[model samples]
Every structure is written in C-alpha cells, then in structure tokens.
Target: MDMKIMRAIELGKTYRDGEKETEVLRQINLEIEEGEFVTIAGPSGSGKSTLLGLLAGLDKPTTGQVFIGENEITSLNENLLAKIRGKMLGFVFQSFNLIPTLNTLENIELPLFLNKIHDVNRAKELIDLVGLSHRSKHYPNQLSGGEQQRVAIARALVCDPPIILADEPTGNLDSRNSKTVIDLLVNLSAEKSKTVIVVTHDLDFAQKAKRVIHINDGRIQ
Candidate 1:
C-alpha cells in the first residue's frame, strides 16, 4: 500500500501586522502515514494550528513544501487545491462550524450535495455511525454542544476522506462529551484506515493518539 498521506519539508508560516512580523512555524518537517493517528500538542501561542492549516492546505506556507499523497499542495493553485481537498481531506473545527439553518441530517449531507453525491442512504449511515440518528432532524442551534460536535464529526466523515484534520475538536465540549468525540475519532480512524492528525492543547487528548508531536516556539520539540 502507498503509506504516505502527508509530508512537510522545511515548512514555515509567518504573519505580518503593520511593521512587525510574527513567525508561527519555522523549518518544520513531518510525515504522516496512512492509518496513523497523530496528535500535535503545543502552547497557546505556539504554531500547532498554523501547522495544521498548512498540512490541510487551508493556508499556504511562507516557505517549504507540502505533499498530500502524490500531489504537491504547495505548488497547486487555490482551485486545484480546493478540488484535492474535497476529494482527499475532511475537517473538524473547534466551533463545529455547521450551517445555522441546516438540520443535523442536512448539515451532514452538505458535502455530498456540494460534490453532487445524491445518496441519502450514505448520509444516514454516517449519522448512525456518530450515534446521532435520533437527533438527525435537530438544527445546530437546537442541539447541545456535544450533539453539534457529533454532527460535525458525521459531516466530516460523510465524504469518507482518507485524511481527517481536526483542530481542537474537543475544545468546546464538556468532559464526557470530549471523551465521546475523542473515542469516536480514534475508532473511526482505526476502523476506516484513515490518517488522522489533530492539533490540540489538551495533553490527555494527545496521549490518546498512537503518536504525539510536541511543538513549541515554532519548532517541533
């Protein structure tokens, strides 16, 4: 099997405000293989999220290369990147980021709708996998934080992307909810043979991963 899911070579990200420049990540090199569950942990001001964005092709690096499978994401334009992202990656955000007006079922089906996959059965299966079948008709606003996040997870997995990128996925949930989401994420990755990379400030969450990378002061420690 082709084991390489993502690779970063000398990756760097810098932010500019007025005359000052902030270096977020510098000379970072990493590799994530297929079927791996890896967590990146760092301090609040560290570059965990920045690195995640780069790895997901959400943001471009100031310097270096990012390869997703056989494609060089750094060299691709936004249109091409978006296409690749749609086909190969899924994302879970801290805020859940669901459309306010859409119900759980509709929210989970949005990606498929966008990609023109009109399979309601597939979407229902994802909801069942997240154990949210009963809440499928509830809107994001009507559900609890955990329920909303579960809907987010169902949405993310609906596409069945080989790579899942989660940024503080459990940040807004309570302890029990956090555990539920984390366990579901881990189980999904293992069962589906997906590559999972999460950026989080929670050490416990990091420890749950098969491999953990510590980032501090813009470098992997």
Candidate 2:
C-alpha cells in the first residue's frame, strides 16, 4: 500500500500590502501518496507557484496545515522546517538555478557538500541518470536550455529526497525540450519510486501526468 507522503488541509495563503490583503490560495485540501505523479495546472497568476512553495516548506500559509509523512510542517520553526525540506523535499525551479561557475558535477553535488558529505560517485550516477555524462564537465552557460534544466533535475536528486516539486520546469524550453523534461520527471516516479509533483500552466504537459489538479482563482476545480 502506498503511504501518504504529503497533505494539505484547508490550506490558505495571503499577502498584505499596507491595508490591502490578497489571498492566493483558499481552503486547499490536497494529498499525494508515495510515488504518485501529480501535476498542478492553472492559468497565469493562478497561485500555482505559491501553492508549490507552501508545499515545499518554502513559505508560510495564512491558515490550515501541511504535512509531510507524519510531520506537520506548517507548525515547525524555520530551522526544523529547513531540516525537513533538506531531508524530504527536492525542488526544481523554472530558472534552472544552477551555479554559473560550477561544472555540472559540482552543481549537482552542492547539496551533499553543504551537509559535509563528499561522494563523487553519487553525483556521477545522477549525471548518467539525467543523460548528461558527456557534459558533466560543462558549465551552465555552455549547456542548452534543456540541458540546463536536466542539470537542475540532477541537482534536485542529489540528496535522494523522496518528493520532487518542480515549478514550471518546462517553462523556458522548446517543445522537444519540454517533452524531454516531462519524460525525465515521469521516469523518476515510475523507475525511482519518487513522489513527483509538477506545477505547470501548459495544458498539454499537464495531461501527461497520471492525475492533474486544476486551480483557478485560488480554488481547486
């Protein structure tokens, strides 16, 4: 039986500007089981990324709770939440977010180094997994948009986290590259048994997921 890896109950998020307050998410109740490939799809400015941030423990919600496994992350302090994120969540951003000076291998291994661990073999394995063995020595500027995104994915997996949260991973890619990124993400869930969740505005890409959660005007539809 699959375990519940993530959950959100009546989740809500709001931002304030002086006397004005804007709500981004409203009463969001969601759950994701282990190894499930789920896509959160919505139109522009639909709070998809905000929801992702909350799920990733990168932001605080205005109301409700978020859980990862048995941990109620919404109630944890910053240090504790950061630890949970480090151990359980891996995030891939729309911008790739690779270091410009580091080679592919170093960039992917950054997380391990931060934890005072050094294992070049593990980094090599991810490079091969992402089909970037030939370009492992290349820097960010030397890679194409797709290649950079692949590198980002490899970096996200360096810690071997169970859940991958990608926000608009294919946003900057062409059709072929977009397909490549999606294929890699899907394969991670299928072959690696990782719980994968992606946020995207592209409807066709959203369709590739086994399940899609559509959001509009801060509500799930």
Candidate 3:
C-alpha cells in the first residue's frame, strides 16, 4: 500500500471577531498518499486556502487532528512545527513569493541556507530541472511572470521535501503560463515522486491532478 503522507480528520477552523464568530471550515477529512497529485477545487469563500494552511502546519485547526506522515502536527509546538515544515514540506504561494533582490539561483538556495545547509550543486541541478539555467543570475524583476513562478517552483523543491502544497499557484499567470506551471507541478509528482497538493479554483488546472477534491462551504463534496 502507498504511504499516507497527509491526513486530516474532523478538521475545523473558526474566526472570532469581538462577539461574532465565523466558521470557515468544518469537518474536513482527507487523505493523500505519497507520490499522488491532488487538487482541492472550490469557488471563492469555499475555504480551500484555509485547508491548505492547516495541512502545511501553518495554522492550527479549531477542531481535529492533522497527521503529516507519522507526526500529528496539530499537537506539535510552533518550534517543532517549523522544523517539520522546513524538513518535510515545500510551499508555493499564488504571489510567487520570490525575493526581489536575490537572483534566480540565490532565491532557490535561500531555503538551504536557512536550514544551515550548503548545497550549491543541488541548487544548480534544480535550476536546470526547471529549465531556468540561463536565468540563474537574473533578479526576480528581470524575469517574466512565468520565469518567476518557475524560480519559485525550483526554490520549493530545493529542500527535496516529500510534500509540496501550492495555494492557487497559477492565479497570477495567463492561460499559457498557467498550463506550463501546472504541467511542471504534475511532472514533479510523476517523475520525482513528490506528493503534490494544489488548492485552485481553475477546473481545467485541477483536472490534471490524479485526484480532484471538490470542497464547498468548508465541506468535502
């Protein structure tokens, strides 16, 4: 049987503003196997990103448990959660969160540097893998949106984390660029055997995944 890399049980989240309470997510149960490509699809206000945050250990659920591999992340302290995130999870944001001052290679190497790991050769290989070897020295401002997103993708893979969570990864790109980025993500899951989860509203993009999870009103559909 394939290993279950991520699982959420009875997950829920609520926001409190003064005396008002807003429930964003409720009873979200999910399981993702290693090396599987999965997409969470929903319309606006459907809580897709909120669920991704919980899965990535970026936020705590108000109700149940989240297991990443063998660890129940919901019970881990912030420090330990940070360690888990750095070692086992890679995140790609919709904004392509690249450092403007760092060149392509430097941006990709930043994660390793933060982890106190020096592996320039690995970084170079990732650049090549993403087909961005020629733009290694170019800054984020110097690259096009697609190139910037590619750099972001390469950076996310530098640590070789087993799980990758992308939140609306193609939200900022045109159709052509969106297709390229989605293809790259799919290839990552297939060729590298990475467990990839993407939160997106684009049905066409979500269709590329091995599994599509439709979420509405914070419930799995």
lDDT of 3: 0.91
Against the true structure, candidate 2 reaches a TM-score of: 0.95
The residue-level lDDT of candidate 1 at 6 comes to: 93
Candidate 3 accuracy as TM-score: 0.96
**lDDT rank order:** 2, 3, 1
Task: Flag clash pairs in model 1.
Answer: none
Alpha-carbon shift of residue 25 in model 3 (angstroms): 0.5
lDDT per residue for candidate 2 within 114-195, as digits (tens), equals 7566676999999999999999999999999999999999999988999999999999999999988998998889999999
| lDDT tens digits, residue span 14-89, model 3 | 9889999999999989999999999998889989999999999888899999999999999998889988899999
Residue-level lDDT for 220 in candidate 3: 95
> How well does candidate 1 match the true structure in TM-score terms?
0.96
Report lDDT (Cα) of residue 77, candidate 3: 89
Instruction: Using lDDT, give the best candidate's number.
Output: 2
Model 2 lDDT-worst window of ten = 111-120
> What lDDT score goes with residue 34 in model 2?
95
Model 1 error, position 74 (Å): 1.6
